[model samples]
Target: MSDIDPGQARPPRRVRVDLPGRAYDILIGAGLVDAAGSILAERLPDARLAIVTDETVAALHLDRLTASLDAAGIAHAVVTVPPGETSKSFRQLEHVVDAILAGRFERGDAVLAFGGGVVGDLAGFAAAIVRRGMRFVQMPTTLLAQVDSSVGGKTGINSPRGKNLVGAFHQPDLVLADTSVLDTLVPREFAAGYAEVVKYGLIDRPEFFDWLEWKRAPIFAGGPERAEAIAASCEAKAAVVIADEREAGERALLNLGHTFGHAIEAAVAFDPARLVHGEAVSIGMAQAHRFSARLGLCPGQDATRVEAHLKAAGLPTRLSEVPGAAIAREVLMAGIAQDKKVKRGRLTFILTRGIGRSFIAADVDAAQIDEFLAEELAG
Candidate 1:
């Protein structure tokens, strides 16, 4: 926030997640995907890579990545899954792992996650499990993955019981976040991804939040502003991951809306047609602010500000905005109970002291949550 002036356009940026042993660079730009071979070559020369992506992203961007790799003399194999949250399943994870094994890729090879969050999580998890572990690289094509999922090492498959319930702490070797790829995303997909970008602002970066409030136009328009937003987000997340790579402490603060968002994602059964990750996070973050207000922890105006920003971004800010058939309160609560944040059968949440003042809240009362959720479901 201090270094970059929002009024003046800047350029594409890079941010590093400086973990002790798993440190990696996040290269944010427009045409970096076209440089995928060069990028990986610098890190892992003579690498046999397993490029994991989904059908949708494969259709649009795979050729560019493959050509780039081919030009750089990087040998790789492709494994494409159906594009959706549904791909984050034990079944799909096994398939990806088998595909990688069926090919010439080895444990030393990097498993390249070449799509959105689903591909990132599934591929990264497969990378983690295959032959004990393997190097991973994130080539996030969606806004959600570039700013959030693509950098962090949180990889996993979803359970029928809950979302992201099973995974590992396998970090990526490098992240090539090509901002240009966002151009191919439709409005709704882009908007859903923007929800995660907004999250960094809300998470202990008040000035950044203020910056987002004003720069929505250029940020969405895609330019230096867009790159700045992504860089700033990566910076915020990197700082947190550095402090707590395994969600033991400050890292949990990153789940500002995830506790509620994950529930929404699960209840809708991870259906992209009905809901996407960031859209659910929008509703979840709004719910968090409102829930905080109910607990006298956040001002109503602050909640309003959070809701307003999400709504203006074309993100749904309420549970009712979910597109599918009505999901029952029992189903929603069951999902919450199964959230990975739960500790020893007690629920945990990332509640806000105020905007940019989020903190981990352990053992939040079940009755209060139940009562509050009853109202959310009624709408």
Candidate 2:
């Protein structure tokens, strides 16, 4: 329940997201999952919980979590869905919600999302819609979830139109990011996860981006550097969310690469075989830099540097690099048009003037995007 672990290179760090009347803490470090039951028992005494995880995660880590709950005298039931983006759909959401209801869990009971982004989104959305907004907890077990998805509580299921087209703004009551769990990930997954960390730097914390450029190796090696990066990303997001909880203004900055990323996802039909969220975001971020260069808003060297870093990390930096993702100009345009960022038939893009100077370019010309996609597709 405390933020100390002498065995760790650095003591666990905590970031608070202060929402109006509903503040929550994001705990990032090596042992949060193992300590979750004690943490929860202290935070929400006698509250029942339904643990929602994906099959892959449940197989790998659920037993330890259940053991923790038992040690703390807490009651919990586990519900697991398939691992992947497909699980973040209405069908899976219904299954999760029904499982919770059938388990006789009440509104006061928390739905603990104990996996990566898919489980977090699906389970969080379930918790949001069930019992007219039940309490939810985030026990993120992956690098991607630990840094980005787990903190903000932007939970949702996907729609036929696009990725995250259907979702709700439901903040979590608590977030436990267990960095040790990330050690289980293969290099590709870890690299993909690192993309989100870069995103925070690319957002407004330009200094953080500069830090990552030098410290990426240690960050990936996992220790104090990993903890520091996660804590910083959470702090950065908490500031934006506290200022604009609903993405009505500055929070839109958080979607720096999402517009283009989601378009790529929509075109690929959200296939993990082709690309995952972070990989799409990697390509999208590089594309954003390149697109800005094309628009004469940024220097080409900046775009090249971004692409070089992503490529070195094994992330796709160009549209051509995304496996099995050859999106046509019209299809790309259509997907962008249907993106969540599009408001009233106008498009919003996060373009950069330099590596860390990203700004919202509202009502960007659709023809320009089309022309860019045409060139992007050609390459």
Candidate 3:
């Protein structure tokens, strides 16, 4: 249902990947996986590749990817992981390593993460550890991975302590995004992914958010505008990653909604039955907007507008609606404390001053956060 009109011709959107020496391109278009062999061959050269994917994506598109690699004369092995955040574990990663060893993958061989964010994170982490670091390619199928996780190269597994607690900065050698796979996403998953697409607009691109406001329905329904939106979002993310590859500075800005989002995820143990990543981000962003308004960064109207837009996009926008709102503030703070941005035992929060303007605040008072949580929990 993508909007590519056979009548109109447009060059594929290309974003210069982040790492300087590791610079690559993010190829976005339809039927790209079918054309992936040439792309991978050029980027990877003679590296033997391991295709790490999920059961769902493997069933649908693994053959096409394998066929493409075969035609390119690239030796490859397919490794499938269970499709979920739960699969991002030490045990699962160990299993992948075993598969790599059993398949005789060499030290120079690369791992191809061929699914959504989970596959990207899990496989990227495995690539980082396999023989103490091998190359990896990100083939993100979901919009969330393409827009946020894949471009950044922050690969990790979740811990009971917090999400992404154990990870590394392993940039991919290349990223091939065949937007066509989105066609197979169920309505709920598609809507969940949109939450991440909308975050870039709220965090740094107010104009983009306005553009999205006008195009949400067409995007949801699948049109050319949808493809354009995906390309634009990835471009924005890629530029940010290039400027701050390791997330030591401007990269933290990308976590605008994720701090709250990750906590929501922790509160739910990352069960899709309860919540998905984008849905948590949606609710998190709405709450952060309210907190920002209360801190006098923006008017309350901004929070209302954010809430309206997320709800319209089929995302949850309330904390109380979550099952654990009644839980102690300390529990949520504990999760916030585990954030990678923490320094000297103090939490550094990314707060928005207005749409498209955000700043880091290590001096933000805990009293203010408690007050915000009280209201968020009650209301």
Q: Which predicted model would earn the best TM-score?
A: 2
The C-alpha TM-scores of every prediction are 0.90, 0.93, 0.91
219-269: candidate 3 lDDT, tens digit per residue:
887666777888888888887888887667887777877888877776676
Task: Report lDDT per candidate.
Answer: 0.86, 0.85, 0.81
Q: Once superposed on the true structure, which residue ranges of model 2 sit more than 4 Å away at CA?
A: 1-6
| List of clashing residue pairs for candidate 1 | 204-356
Mark the regions of model 1 whose C-alpha exceeds 4 Å error after superposition: 1-12, 374-379
Q: What would you estimate as the lDDT of candidate 2?
A: 0.85
Candidate 2 per-residue C-alpha lDDT over 1-379 given as tens digits, one digit per residue, 9 for 90 to 100: 3433557735458898888888988888887777888889998887899999988998888888888899899999989899887888889989999999999998888999999888999989999999889899998888888888866668998787556878898889989898888888988899989999899888777789888888888888876788889999888878887898777888888888888998887778777778888899998899899899998998999889888877877788888876763667787788888777888988899998988899998889998888888888877
Candidate whose lDDT is highest: 1
Q: Which one wins by TM-score: 2 or 3? A: 2
Candidate 3: give the clashing pairs: 3-223, 3-224
Off by over 4 Å in 3: 1-11, 323-330
Q: What is the lDDT of residue 204 in candidate 2?
A: 79
